[model samples]
Target: MKSPILRLDTMKFTYISLLILVSPILFLSCKGKFNFSKQKAENEKIVVQYGEHFLTDRDLKLILPKDYTKEDSVNWVKTYIEEWVKKKAIVDKAEENIDELTLKEIENKIVEYRQDLLINAYNNYLIEKNIKDSVTDEELFQYYEKHKDSFPLVKEVVQFRAITVDKSEENQAERLFNSSKDEDFDEVMKMVLQAGNAYHDKDSIWYSPEYIAAQFPELNQNDQLSQLISRRKVKISDENTVTLIKILNLKPKGSTAPYEFVKPTIKNLLLNKRKLNLLSELQNQLYKEAINKNEIKINEN
Candidate 1:
């Protein structure tokens, strides 16, 4: 039976999934405008808005439609225009105060933005052209075999109680060990596993070795904790307080993952590799052209 919290969590997940599924379709219906092409000046273009300071488009659709009504769009446009005007006013004021170097810096920024936009446009085109739905199960399996160690299967974690005490508690611990001899070893272990005043269950008493090693670095070894205590017994303040540990349970690490376990992940990795390969080929072709045409120049200075 699922807990109420779990059920609510599941419902929350379902709600999110439904929202994700319907969001794009709803956005498309309300605001049909989308920008697949990179921003570039065309010979023929529709002028949505033009002002003394700035220009914007009616095609600049709102990303957050759920928060605003249709009347809000009008207000948004007005606010946007006002903001642009304010920004331009500040820029114009700054321009009047700028030196030759500042103007040169601004020109350099414009060139960088142009180059960035062009690269993004080219990458988008290459992605559309080269990437395809050709990755099969066999392909994924082969890829996984090649890169099996990249993603190891989630290992099963073991829980065990460990108590470290000084030499002063030796007598108390010896007495307890002797008294608990007749009792079931497991039961004795469960009983002794107490934090503060309350006793935690056997399952809850201990933690995985990995977790323990991280939290309590004093435990000494990665593989075994028992070796650390036996070597050197430190002094304890109270003789009555016994250092006791319990090995609640052992959960061995899981084996290597099968091909089916990582098929989807391997498929994605293979697709990325193909995309990179395509990009490299295009880059080489462009490099050759630049060299042939003497478009690229090298300056030692």
Candidate 2:
């Protein structure tokens, strides 16, 4: 689940999304010089002012995601300003109701949280700057061998090519399919494509039987597809259309996925593991170096 702060921001952006849909022409007209950060703090103009607490144009612009168009810039700033106003209102009311002692405690907690946030952000920045990103094929293979059980193929999947067409085109498709040979598979596909409403040529991409069924909505389940996958070509004719399914490749359930198929997943796992290890290593080294230089002190109880 997203944090409340993040969810609020997302909801705030949704208004902008809807507004963009409502009137693209008007939204475009509303667009102006939206680079809020270009202005100095002294020159910064207020977009939302809630009595004592105010939000600046720079603040809204910084929070907006990159690649925002001129219309997006205007809408997001307006959305964020409205959100900030609501938040400030609640905060002001809460402050009035709370006792000074409780408010002081809350302020202390916020200070601590702010410090921790900055420190952690800087730590991540340093770790990212120093960490190695690319994992080698050798590294992946070694990790996979050691942790094979951790990566299980839970679902039945297959690789296949299929074509679907209206019943009228079924005879011509079947004739073209039969006339084409394996070596001329590409050319055969081109011919098959024209005769079908939808088609997928044989490719390296893998798909679950459930996914294939979901994609077509003609096949019942994975088992039905699995049974037909080994055959050269299976044609099913219905009231509306005829569908042809051909198995390019198949990976049975419980079978370990190929290294290439899982390379990306393995790479991300390795990267995270390396990052954690590096953090531990750097923290220990820094602590020891700090003690040696008398930069950090501990008072005995």
User: Which candidate should be chosen as best, given lDDT against the real structure?
Assistant: 2
C-alpha lDDT values of all predictions = 0.51, 0.66
TM-score of each: 0.45, 0.59
How far in Å is the alpha carbon of 138 misplaced in model 1?
Answer: 2.6
Model 2: per-residue lDDT, tens digit, 112-175?
9999898678767866787556678899999888877676677756677777766776676666
In candidate 1, stretches whose alpha carbon ends up further than 4 angstroms from where it belongs are 1-52, 56-70, 155-254, 293-301
Candidate 2 all-Cα RMSD: 10.8
Best by TM-score: 2
Backbone clash tally (model 2):
0
Error of 1 at 187 (Å): 43
* Residue pairs whose backbone atoms clash in candidate 1: none
TM-score of model 1 (CA atoms): 0.45
Worst 10 residues of 1 by lDDT: 47-56
lDDT of 1 by residue, 1-301 (tens): 4433333334444433433343232222324554433353453233222222323232334321445544454455445544544675677678789998988999899999999899878877877766767687777877777877776557534444444334554455444443535354344444455322122234443344556546444455443354423332222133444444444444434644555545777777878887878878988999999999999999989
Number of residue pairs clashing in candidate 1, backbone atoms closer than 3 angstroms, sequence gap of 3 or more or interchain? 0
